[model samples]
Target: RLSNVLKRFARRHPDVALTLRTATSAEVSDLIRRGEATIGLRYDRDRSRDLDCEVLFAEPLGVVCAPDHPLAGRRVGKLADLRDERWIAFPEVPGRREITASHVFALFLTHGLGEVAWTPVDSLTAQKRLVEAGLGIALLSQSNAAEELGSSRIATIRVGDLAASHEVVAVTRHGGFLSAASRRLLDILRADFTKARGTNASRRNGVRRA
Candidate 1:
């Protein structure tokens, strides 16, 4: 979803240099606070007064798994049924911020399934790949793995207790200057998300492999 907005940004501002560094939401906020980056996009809101945060949109989260998995096209009646399944998620640890795996892992614990099996993977692409390889299932946004879902390379399972969503927020240093190029990119991002908010809903309303 963000790639399309960036493609447009690149075409319109060919002279602008775009460097992307991916990290957890807190790390992204820290990068901006220390001036390592001018603008950052991340999941969830940052409470720090040091940065200006704008929520771009909220994305629905769901389980992702291999296409041929037993739960691929089926509805999960109870969360306990997944206790024996290996999950590709983050292991709860200190200073762990919820954005990727932590949020997914918390879902299980919230339901009293604290001992659920999970594999820690930091990269989003790698999580999807591992799911495809049948290593484990993952909780992810539909748009995050749109291509795989569209191609039937992965599938989504309807877990009644796992209905959740996370916000995509844009952050920048609170009292810092934004270059013309940076402002332009922000404008494009906002406009792109506004236009896409509706269609993206329909496209991912009933999908996933987890």
Candidate 2:
């Protein structure tokens, strides 16, 4: 979504130089607080006084697996069938602030199937690659796996009782200077990010429904 916003932002201000930085959710906050980056986008909101957070959108996370995986195109209704599948995800610790790790298991624990087989991989790229290789399945947002999902290389595995999403928020240093370019980019984000993410979600859901 930010990429799309940047495309337009760039067109409007060709003189501006835009550099994007990537990091974990926790790292993003730290970067903003230390003035390493003028604008930061991260999952979930932070409560500290060093930054101001505004939610851009929620990216829905669901069961994603290889196209040929047994559960790829099925509507899963029970926890029993999912208990034994190999899960590739971030290790989840209850009551912790995690961007991508916790969504995969909360539903399992809620349904009384606390024991699950999972491998922890810190990188989202590695997790997706593992799932695509048929090594394991993962709980992931569509945006994170857009390329794979769009090309039919990966597919969504829907659980009847599952609902999980992480909010993508725009973060900036509190009482910090905002450049015209920065403010304009933020304006683009504020104006169009939801529609962009919403369209992506609809397209993915349509594919799943079909």
Candidate 3:
């Protein structure tokens, strides 16, 4: 979504030359720290001290599985219930892996379920394919799971007691100054996401429908 906003901004301001790089939140932060990129859009939790960040929006993460999976019809499940299930998880490179690992570890320590086994996959598309094949279950952002969940290609299982959320953020070097074009591009991105978030909030609150 942030990428799309940037694309539109570049089109609207053709005089601005934009170079964009998309990667995991961690990688984006690294690039900013190394001065490879002037500005970035990344998850708030993944931001580094090397950059200044502004919160854009918060999004929830949900559990996803094949339509025929045993947990498909379940409205919610406890984290411990997934102990024996085959899990499809993000690779080591993904920032979410660290967050997921911490959650898993905490759950295990509290419930004594021991360590759960999982397959590390790098791409969301591949992970979704694996879930649809009934090979395993996964954790995914609601935005990413929207199409599949709506089409019934996959089922969403809520984690009742778990608070899983991610925030999208805009970041730039702490003391670095942005060029006029870059600043204008940033303004466009902020406005675009602000509008999108308002729409999503309204829909979620039942004030409007998608």
* lDDT per residue (tens digit) for residues 17-94 in model 3: 777777777777788888899888776655456689887777767778999987795865577778777777765544
Alpha carbon lDDT at 94, candidate 2: 40
Q: Can you write out model 2's per-residue Cα lDDT over 1-210, one digit (the tens) per residue?
A: 667788999999999999998887788899999999999988889888889999998777778899999888788887557889988887654423453344556677777777677888878888888898999988887678888899988888888777677888899999999999999889889889777666768775884333
| Residue 129 lDDT in candidate 1 | 93
Ranking by TM-score: 2, 1, 3
Output the TM-score of candidate 1: 0.79
Model 1, CA-based lDDT: 0.81
Candidate 1 or 2, higher TM-score? 2
lDDT for each residue of candidate 1 in 18-82, tens digit (9 for 90 to 100): 98897877789889999999989887788888889998887787788899898996889767778
**How do all models score by TM-score?**
0.79, 0.86, 0.75
RMSD of each: 4.3, 3.6, 3.7
What's the distance in Å from true for residue 33, model 3? 2.2
Query: Ranking under lDDT, best-scoring first?
Result: 2, 1, 3
